[model samples]
Target: MSLEIRIAAPEDAFAACTVLRRSITECCVADHKDDPAILGAWLGNKTPQTVASWFESPTNYSLVALKDGAVIGVSLLTGAGKLALCYLLPEARGLGAGKAMLAKVEETACNWGVKAVQLHSTATGEEFFASQGYVRSGHVRSPYGVDTIFFWKQLDRGAAPDTSQRKRFCNCNSA
Candidate 1:
C-alpha cells in the first residue's frame, strides 16, 4: 500500500474527522471499553467543523496520512509542545503510518524550536509511543473517565527538562 503524509488542509477536515472518530471508536476499544457514555463524551467534539478549526489554528499543526489517496490517520501538535492527537483507523495499524506521522510531528517540533513533546496516550497507544522512544512520565484519570498514560520525549539533549506543572491536553478532549 502506498502511504503519504502531509500537512492537513481545510478541505481535508471531514476525512480527517472520520479517521479520528473511527480510530477512537474502533481502535481505542481498550480505553473506552465499548461504553456508549465514554464514547459519546470522547467523540463529542470530533466533528468536521472542529477538525477544520484545528487545521486553521495558527498555533496548531495538523497532519493527515493517506493510504492510496484516502485519509487513514490524523495527528495534531500544539505550539506548546503537546502532541494532542495521533490516531489511525483500525485497518491502518501496523502499516508504519503512525510512526511516519510521529516522525514528521517530531521534525515539525524541532523546526519550531520545541525541545520536548508530550502526550497522553490511550491504553491501546501506549505501546506504540513507547516503541517510538517516548518515556512514561505519569498516569492520570482523564476527563472522560479513562486512565491514561502521559508520555514525553526530549528532542534536545542539551535542553533542561520541563518541570513546571501544566494542565494536560488529553487526546480525547483536545480543542
Candidate 2:
C-alpha cells in the first residue's frame, strides 16, 4: 500500500496516540513483558493531550503516515536533535512508511542545524536502527528499568540509505 507522510496537526493527536498505544501494547511485549505496571509507567505520558501539545509545537517536527487517509505511523524529531517518537501500527510495518518518515525527520533535523540525532530505542528497535546506519552510543536505564540502547547517527550526504524499505519485523516493532 502507498503511504503519504505529512506534518502532524493538533487534531491528529488522538490518531497518533492510538497508533502509539496499539503498537506498543500489542507488539512490544518483549520490552514490556505485558506487565501492567511497566506498561502503565511507559505509556504514562502518551496521552492525546501530550501528543497534541507536541503536534502544536512549531519547534517539534512531528509527522504521521497515512494510508487511505488513516494514520498508521507517527514520528517526532525535536529541535534538540532527539527522535522523541516513531511508531507504526502492525499492519503498516512492511510498507515504506517507516523509512520515509525517518528520512523526513533526518532531513528536518539537518535543516534545523542539528549535526547528529540521538534516540533511545527498545530491544525491538535496536536492529532496525542499526540497519538504518545508527550506531549504539551506549546504554541507558529505561524508566521501567530496562537497559535501552542509545543510538546516534551523524547527518551527512551519505548517512542512511534511502533504500526501498525492507519488510522485517524484529524485536523493535517501532522506535
What lDDT does the true structure give each of the candidates?
A: 0.94, 0.90
Q: Name every residue pair that clashes in candidate 2.
A: 124-171, 124-172, 125-172
Q: On residues 1-175, what C-alpha lDDT tens digit does candidate 2 reach at each position?
A: 5579999999999999999998888878898888898899888898999999999998899999999899999999998999989899988886989889999999999888788899999888888889899999899988765668999988975666555788776858776
* lDDT tens readout by residue for model 1, 1-175: 8899999999999999999999998889999999999999999999999999999999999999999999999999999999999999999999999999999999999999999999999999999999999999899888987899999999998776666786776868765
How do all models score by TM-score?
0.89, 0.87
Q: What lDDT is obtained when candidate 1 is compared to the true structure?
A: 0.94
Best by TM-score: 1
TM-score of 2: 0.87
